[model samples]
Target: MTSLFVDRRGVVLELESGAIVFRENGERIGTVPIAPLSRVFLRGDVKLPAALLGKLGEQGVGVVILSGRIGRPSLLLARPHNDAVRRVAQIRLSFDEPFCLQIGKTLIERKLTRQIEWFTELRENDMQVRYELSHALRALEEHWPRIGHASSAASLRGVEGSAAARYFSGLQAVVPNSLHFSGRNRRPPRDPFNALLSLTYTLLHSEIAIALYGAGFDPYVGFYHRLAFGRESLASDLLEPLRPLADQFALALIRKKVLEKDHFSTTEAGCLLGKAGRTRYYAAYGEHSETLRKGINQEIEWLTAQVNEIMATAEDDVRSEDDFEDFG
Candidate 1:
């Protein structure tokens, strides 16, 4: 299944015979079969009947509404997985300090490895950027062994943050000079490159959160990222390995000039992508969504297996203890 992105202003959506009909000014514009859609992203002034939302929920289609200047998202999810056992196991694992640390180490290791791989790829391809990419690669390589040595989540996060700084520095060198990208900055990203990164990361996070919810995992209870109010920590954890991919997508957009300086405007709220830029951005993103989703699903499957293995081990240990007590 694919995702449907509706960004047009003043468009009305209706459910007509198992298809989503798009109308503007009372004239039919387009229609899409709901059967082929896994999710729908609605942005700006799009209108849709309440009945259509009901139909979407009934069909197990997730809805993501992007609002405000920066397009903060609000998720209207379908019915989550019926199995609560996996959620219970996840909660149990979250409290297991040793398990959490191991998971954190694994996540950081994977992330740093991917970042190093990307820099290595760039270093091999472009001689002009070699100096910068080599430096970043060395920094990431230094952090790789540290992930296994990290004693706590706090230390692991520190290693990850340092690696990310180096990665972004390498990225800054590769992007066009006109883009004016320095290092990574967010929460109202100050630069066009940062804006694109923030937007792409948000979409990636949303995709992972939806996948986690569908697979019966608690998105908020993460092993690596500490619990925070309103944060999908598990999704944050799962997205770590894939962040380089998102970063690459943003870089590609800037480097290829699919997104340019003219596509952005700055206000007191900081740099923001205009509607025209977003239209092009979404189109480009659609081309990559399938691959992104497939990667996310693979991660989710890995996490599910890990949780099940941990739960099974715990149960076996309990049974062994009970047998020992009875024998005594």
Candidate 2:
């Protein structure tokens, strides 16, 4: 299935001839067959009418609108996953302290392991940077136990934050100096590199949300991320392991010179890629995203099985405990 991305400004989408057509100044511009599309990304100033939206909804195609060019997306999904029992189990298990913390530890450790592997495999020629990355690799391995032992979500998040600072610091050593990226920043990322990171992570968030929805899970509810207004916390939870993928693309774009400083513009809002740069970025990002798609689906499928298994095991342990108490 195809994923449609409409990044052009001032384009209106409408339904015509069983296809989604783009219009500009009341003139036909382009069209795509709606039948093959599984997802749509509307970025920056594009309009989508109700009829077109309705058709997408009917076809079970997810829509993600990138409003204001950053942060989380406005995702349009079909009705909720059909598994009420699993949904209830997920909600209950989220509140299960032992279970949630255990799962959180696994997620954080997986991410840190990926970070270590990345630095180890980096083909940097700078001896100094390589030495620092080697040190960071050891530091990330040390943090794994700290994450596993975290007693609360707040504590777990704190560990994750420290790991990010450590990870990006090592990353800063490899990227071009012109980007001036020191560490991770979001909610109006101050520099071009951080802005690119934010954009890519948001895109990852949208994809994971759609995948979770397709896998019969509620994207809004999560085990690790605290419930918040309008936040798809479960998607954030899943995105932890794959953040390095976004980092990989951002570094490739800068280090490989696919994008340069001239391709970006800064405004009062923040740094952002220009139209042409964004087009190139979308093409590059699309390919990278395709490679990650297989992993995303596999991870979600595995998480679904893990959730069911853990809940069942927890229930069995409780029953055994009650039996022992009754016998005593």
Candidate 3:
């Protein structure tokens, strides 16, 4: 699956025959074929033809329009499913409290365990991390047992937030200070290296959200992530298991110091990635996306197995294979 990321500033995206031409500075420097593509991300002031979007939709490729400075998706174009009932059923099943919560708990717990495991491995080299990892593990261990008893999404989310805070603290501490990187912040990443990491991670999250939506999950309904305006809570829930990959990608880039200060810019309001920064981030994102997609597909396969087992044990009238695939 290919995700075309467009972050070039002041570029024009126009359909030329069966391909897209990218024109910059009165020159044609790029062309992308409208084939073998899964998604397109429009992230700049580029313009697109209406017919091209229609063709992309017809090809079962997703197109997302993103606004600059906002850093969130603005619009999406995708092919309509012919089997509407199946898609609708998937959404309902994904939103069902019992089913969604159970699956979410499994996902979060697995991810928490992975984070703990990674922390332990890291602590072997850095003794300072021991205290924080121990605390994080303690909280995760304490929080996991309550998943089964959580009555509302809020309770589960609280558990997740606590665990995440501890984990992020440990992760930030492990990085050397020479990189000029600090812990996570709400505003755009202040440093160039952090900006690159953030941009790539955001792109990865957006791609995962699209996949979750295609899977028929209610992207807004979630177990571990709180619901907020324009927040894809369900996507956040599903992304727990996939974060380590992005973390690894960021860590690699930072260690190499491939990102320089020139890659980023700052405004009075916030920092933003420049053209070169976006290009490098997108390249990394494409590589990271391939790895994460395979992992997600594997997770889906595992879930399918568990659902199949449930169907096998339940009465045929109560549980059917049809219902199993709906959530898959």
Q: Rate the local accuracy (lDDT) of all candidates.
A: 0.88, 0.82, 0.68
| Whole-model alpha-carbon lDDT for candidate 3 | 0.68
Best-to-worst ranking by lDDT: 1, 2, 3
Candidate 2, residue 241: CA error in Å? 0.7
How does model 1 score by TM-score? Answer: 0.96
The best candidate by TM-score is 1
- Please say which candidate is ahead in TM-score: 1 or 2: 1
Which residue ranges in model 3 land beyond 4 Å of their true spot? 25-27, 124-152, 178-182, 187-198, 221-229, 266-268, 299-315, 318-328
> Once superposed on the true structure, which residue ranges of model 1 sit more than 4 Å away at CA?
318-328
Name the better of 2 and 3 by TM-score.
Answer: 2
How do the residues 1-328 of candidate 1 rate in per-residue lDDT, one tens digit apiece? 8889999889999989999999999999899999988889999899888889988888888898999888998888888899999999999889999999988888778778778888899899999999999988888898878888888888888888888888888888898887778998889898888899899999889888888999999889999987999999999999999998898888888778898999998777888899899989998998888888988998898898899898899899998988885435
> Model 2: clashing residue pairs?
none
Q: Per-residue CA lDDT of candidate 2, range 1-328, in tens?
A: 6678888878988898779989998899998999987778888878878988888887878898877655357888855577787777888778887877777788888888778878888835567587878877777777877886788888999999998888888888887788888887777887889888888888888888988887788888888886899898889888898888778878888877888888888888888878888888877876676766776787798788888897788789998988884435
Q: RMSD of each candidate?
A: 1.5, 3.2, 5.7
Q: lDDT, candidate 3, residue 129?
A: 69
Q: Using lDDT as the measure, name the better of candidate 1 and candidate 3.
A: 1
Winning model by lDDT = 1
